[model samples]
Target: MTTRHDLQTRLERGIAALGLQLPAGAVERLLDYQALLARWNATYNLTAIRDPGEMVSRHLVDSLAILPYVQGATLADLGTGPGLPGIPIAIATPEREVLLVDSNGKKVRFLREAIRSLKLENVRAVQSRVEEVEGQFDCVTARAFASLADMLAWGGHLLTKSGIWLAMKGKHPEDELAGVPDGYEVRAIHELHVPDVGGERHLVVLGRTGC
Candidate 1:
């Protein structure tokens, strides 16, 4: 079992390594979110990741590794399964307004409960398909949810004219990059090295180069 102290220790190290400044008690709230997730997972099976310690690396650290790159004042995490990076991102950056979008009812409910439980004033959960969801955000993110083309097809409209699209990918998506839709261009590709996580991790950032 991943105790609170154990996760806190690991989380602190990760925050330091990543050069992230989490607000006071934000760590405890993140750990609170983790504990709540674990408790709910016992009955709902929210995620396949069972070990709490692993969640720290794969779910928490991996999700937060891109904090330095996240931009803008508003964000929409499309196809956000169990609020991978959305909830954590909101918790870490309370200044930004975060909308956690997911199609699964269970996950949506979980996100709602988490938001309420965490008392996150800047975050909200929306249950709907990404394309059908309303509102334009300054930034949009889809985490390992789908191919770059497909993700953009569904959620690109949510991004503002100058907004950025960030996608969490397992590796350098050469094929996906080749298939990027028109009007959007790949701006940057960051190779992520999540703490305690093996294997390749990359973050693909896209933006509109032309109208």
Candidate 2:
């Protein structure tokens, strides 16, 4: 088993390579959060990706890829299973309020426990469908939850009139872009470079053009 210290070292290295200017003690908190996730994943199977090192790359780094594109003071991560992107963003950007939305009860339980254990004051895990989630946020994010059109259709209401949505994908979603609804437009598809990981990773930035 990889010791916690070893995982911390790898995470620190990965964070440094990623060039993220995290808040004080954010790294430690992230490690703690990862530990909790691993513990819960053993039986609950929160995520498919195992291995602490890979978690640092796939989970931590993949989530951090949107840091540069994050807009505004509040963000809602729709279909945020196990608090990907949202939880890490909350730990890194303590100023931004992050809400993780997912309908899965087990996942929500894990998210709540993670929030409590990490002592993250800025993150809240809500058990609700994306379409039913209330409030408009400055930014919204989802990870391959559904088609771009479907994603916007269901969660678009959560985004402010001029807010942005950063959708994480493993490859460029050309097919998904064909039907991006009416009010939303593709601003730019950013190709993310996550350290210690290979293959394609992109953050599709979708901005609302109308109210």
Candidate 3:
């Protein structure tokens, strides 16, 4: 059993190396989330990774890898299946309110349970599609969700005037970016380097321009 202290040390070291700051006690809550995930995964099949250590690197750490670039006040995670970047980001920024939306009932149930177990008051797990979730947000994020253009189309309305869309994608998103809707602008494209995971990861940040 990996204790919260263990995860704390790892998270602290990892974040420091990456040059980022997260709220205190994030490690404990993250560990709690991981525990809940493992327990629920048995029945729900939410995530493919089962090993705790692998979960730390692949799910927890991998998600936090984008911490260096997220800019916003309130964030909404579209298609937050099993609460990937949403849960981790919520833990990192305890002050920022985060909404995790998913259509799958089982995944939403697991997300709600994880939030409760982690005592994450800032996180709201909503069982709904991205389009159904109303209210303008400072940032909308997705991981392994949809094509870049599709993500923009579905989550566009949720963004505030200057709000951003943080879409995490694999190696080449050139084809996907070709069809981006008219009003959004590509702010930046950052490559992620997860410690042990082999593959090219890119974080595409799209901002609303008054075009």
Candidate 4:
């Protein structure tokens, strides 16, 4: 059984390793969100990673690892299963307006509960498919949701002209690069080193052509 203190220690070390200075009390709120997810996950089966320690590393810190790449004031997380990255991002940066979209009702319900329990003022959860979601955002994030082409095809319209798309993927995704849609171009690919995570993590940054 992993204690909350143990989880906090791990999270603190991970954040320090990532070189992030999160807002005051952000760490505690992130843990609060994690605890909420764990409680709901036991009944709802929201995520496969069960152990609290692994949750601290793979879910919380793994999400925060991409914080430096995240830009703009508004962000939409498509196919945000159980609010991975989105919820943590929201907790870390309360000033950024975040929208977590997912087709799964249970996951969306859990997101709403997290927002309420965490007192997140700048977050919203919408139960909708990626293509049906409305509005434009300054940043769009998709975490291992779909291929590069398919993700842009569905959610490309949500990104503002100057906005960037942060696509999180495991491994390099070499095969998917050629499939990027016509208008969007791969701006950069960053190799992320998440503390305590055993697998390779990559963040593919995309933007409109000539932007």
Candidate 1 lDDT, 168-191, residue by residue in tens: 999789988888888899999999
Candidate 2: worst 10 consecutive residues by lDDT?
11-20
In terms of lDDT, the poorest run of 10 residues in model 4 is 30-39
Residue by residue across 161-182, what tens digits does model 4's lDDT show?
9999999999999999999999
Name the runs in model 4 displaced over 4 angstroms.
none
How far does residue 182 in candidate 3 sit from its true spot (Å)? 1.1
Task: Pick the lDDT winner.
Answer: 4
Give lDDT: candidate 4, residue 55.
Answer: 94
Model 1: what TM-score? 0.97
Give candidate 4's TM-score. Answer: 0.99
Largest TM-score belongs to which candidate?
4
What C-alpha lDDT, on a 0 to 100 scale, does residue 45 get in candidate 4?
Answer: 98
User: What are the per-residue Cα lDDT tens digits for candidate 3 across 148-206?
Assistant: 88888888999999888889988868888778989888888998887656788999989
- What would the TM-scores of all predictions be? 0.97, 0.96, 0.92, 0.99
Q: In every candidate, how many clashes are there?
A: 0, 0, 0, 0
Error of 4 at 123 (Å): 0.1
Q: In model 3, which regions exceed 4 Å deviation?
A: 1-13
Model 4, residue 185: distance off in Å is 0.4
Measured on C-alpha atoms, candidate 1 has an lDDT of: 0.90
Candidate 4 pairs with clashing backbones: none
